[model samples]
Target chain A: MNHFFEDSVFFGVTLSFLSYGLGVLLKKKLKLGILNPLLVSIVITVIVLVVTDMDYEIYYNGAKYISYLLTPATVCLAIPLYEQFEILKKNVAAILAGILSGVLTSLSCILAMVLIFNMNHKQYVSLLPKSITTAIGMGVSEELGGYVAITTAIIIITGVFGNVIGEFVLYIFRIKEPVAKGIALGTASHAIGTAKAMELGEIEGALASLSIILSGIITVGFAPVFAQIH
Target chain B: MKYLRQFGIILFISFLGEIANYAIPLPIPASIYGIIILFLCLELKILPLSSVKETGKFLIEIMPVMFIPAAAGVLNVWGIIKPSVIEYIAVMVISTIAVMAVSGLVTQLVIRLTGHSGHQ
Candidate 1:
């Protein structure tokens, strides 16, 4: 079994697809917030390697190809942002302000954590991009000399947390406007929160999509500046 | 054939972004440069929506799966992360909620102040 997996050129890719597919199925069946497809996929993939005693390097040999798509996939994000452009135009100021505040809040919070917890610069930079999408966040983390893997995990955790409590937080704040709700979720949670936004209403969904792109850009520009703090 | 062309366009833009990243002194990543360029092209009607729409959707749909390899790297660094796990979780939870509340409230306030009605 080890030799077979070792020699197969496509073994890692095959396992990834199978695990991710299973994760999607489980999410559909279980309907649990903690059962995020990405989280499930990671768990399954990790378990498979550990149980099989397979080397992570060997698994990554085939898995690396899939990561090559990350850049193009991020570029494709522009399409959705473009599709939602008209809605963005209608309430530009409110959307921009909302996303800006969210980005600032994210930065300041990370800064405070660094000071309060006495986190090293590496840890500080890793968490700086925690609230953005995984693709962009990973890039920011790498550029700032932080652990990209830890940043990815942190990003997924943040998104999952946001998805779970996003609506509840909005309700507590008495934020009734569709635009405000969308901005809050997307700005705070990235794509995972956008999933919740999609459930609320069409306007909220569109606005959330827009906020994801805008907030990502804002974080990219600002993460470097904040990384300078520690 | 169509999907191939769409992918080619995205790849070309990404290549351009790579060049820009090397040229620009800022800390911005190539992917961001690609995003900005693609967005401008679409906004200026330089690239029609149909040119990249279908393939773009396909790529985005599968985005999460692409992160598996990177996320799995965490297993190797567990020792480094173990001690600070609690602090990491604390910062994430506190900041996430704070950001959600602040962003929502500020947007709500701004919309009201601007008299946009926000009803639409």
Candidate 2:
């Protein structure tokens, strides 16, 4: 099976598209509240890699074409952000205050764990930006001599996990306000979590988008200072 | 003509961020430095909304794709990461829920205190 498709772009794109497509199909059919398309796709891809014993480098080589799309996708977020600026501006103070508090909470908890476990600085630094998005978190972690791979894993896990349970917890607490729900998830979990918040409602989606950026900015601002303290 | 100036401003800040990241002793990443510079620019009216809006919008749209590169790292850790998959999974699941609960409660409390009453 591996020899047949040793060098083919279709290999990567097909696996990616198929995994995500099937995941989305499962999500719709099963009505599984937390079955994220991205997560499921990733799992499927990993299983393929392991089963076929194919090299990850080869898979990435084929997928590199699609990877270029990331820049434009990031740029697309501006539309919603611009559209929702009115709400963001109106509640800027409260929202900022809440988001910052949540960020602080996540960082503090991670640092506390580091100390409790008696982990070394390498582990400590890797987890420093655990709550932020992967790109930024990986960068910060590498600069501080931490493991970027671990940090990236932590960031994605945090994002997918936050997204999966975020809405349910909101319902559990009887917190129905779209704006509040959006801000909470985005600030705590970043973009993927925000995407889930969007599914709940437009207002929630808007707020989540706004919060994701704001939280990223805040995390960017706080990471250095926080890292220094630890 | 105006758009040109906005583009220049963003590019300049991005450059400044890179420079500061290399030259300064601050323990922060450069792109983040750019974000800080941009944030200050927005606050000071040095970079108007109309100008930076397009560039900012561009970055936000494709934000998800950024994960692709990092997700690639999963490959590097394949051998090591697999051993503790279940442990990591538990942490991932539990911590995500914890974050949602705590952040949601805190946000709602703040909203209630602020008295917006917009929540429906």
Candidate 3:
């Protein structure tokens, strides 16, 4: 059993796929709030790794191939952004200004939380880019000497949390504007929240796509300056 | 052959982005460079939208699966996360809501100011 997991080629796919399969099954079977396939898969993977006493490097060795797909996936965002170009052109100024504030708010909120909770600097840096996609968020965290794993965790949590609660917040605040809803979804949760925005309508989906990239670009540019702040 | 070619286009752009990262003076990442190049390609009519549209949608639809490994890596940092789990959740939830409110309000305000209806 121990040596079985040591093989990168076999371990990563076998375990990851098995866990993900189970996750999908559970999601279909159970209608619980915590039935997130990603979360379920991660929890199972962690448990299996811990139980087998297998090294993450071995697991990652195979899993990194899947992770590499993110590059093309990131590029794929251009299609929807392209589809939404007309709307983007019409509201370019509003979208840009909203994104500019969205990026700053995300950063400042992290800082404010750190100050209020007196959290450590390392964690602060790690959480700075939670509002964007993992690829850019990981880069921002690594550049600032933050722990990448921590950043990844915070990011997944933020995305899932926002995805779950976004509508309630919108309703409570009476935020009826589609542009507002789309911007909120993309800026706060990146792609996952954009997935929710898609269900709202085409314009919302397009706006969400536009906002994710805009927010990512803004975060990339804003991160260094933020890193230097504290 | 078709999807392969489309994927190839994106991969080639990614390759150029990797090269640009080192060559360019700016701090932008290769992925961003790729995104920018691709966006411009679409905008300038250099890369027709139809070629990549299918492959792009196919890739984006399954993007969630790619995040598994990255999120699974969190096991390594469990020690840090365990101590501040509550604080972490509090901060994340609060900040997420705050960012959403701020961005949404700002977008609506900006749209209204620009004489756009934003009625929907």
TM-score of each: 0.82, 0.77, 0.84
| Candidates' RMSD to native | 3.4, 5.1, 3.2
**Tens-digit lDDT string for candidate 1 (A1-230):** 86776677788888888898998899899987677677788889999999988899889988988988888877776776677667667778888888999999999998998799999999999999998887678889999999987898888778867876887899899999988998899899887677667667656766776777778889989989998878
True contacts kept of 2: 0.29
Q: List the residue pairs that clash in candidate 3.
A: none
Question: What is the CAPRI rating of model 3's predicted complex?
Answer: medium
Chain B alone: TM-score in each candidate?
Answer: 0.87, 0.79, 0.86
> What's the lDDT for all of these models?
0.84, 0.67, 0.79
Using DockQ as the yardstick, the better of models 2 and 3 is 3
Candidate 2 regions off by >4 Å? Answer: A1-4, A228-230, B1-75, B80-95, B117-120
DockQ of 3: 0.58
For residues B37-91, what per-residue lDDT tens digits would candidate 1 score against the true structure? 9989999999999999999878877876777787776677777778998999899
The best candidate in terms of lDDT: 1
TM-score of chain B of 2: 0.79
The better candidate by TM-score, 1 or 3, is 3
TM-score of 2: 0.77
DockQ of each: 0.58, 0.26, 0.58
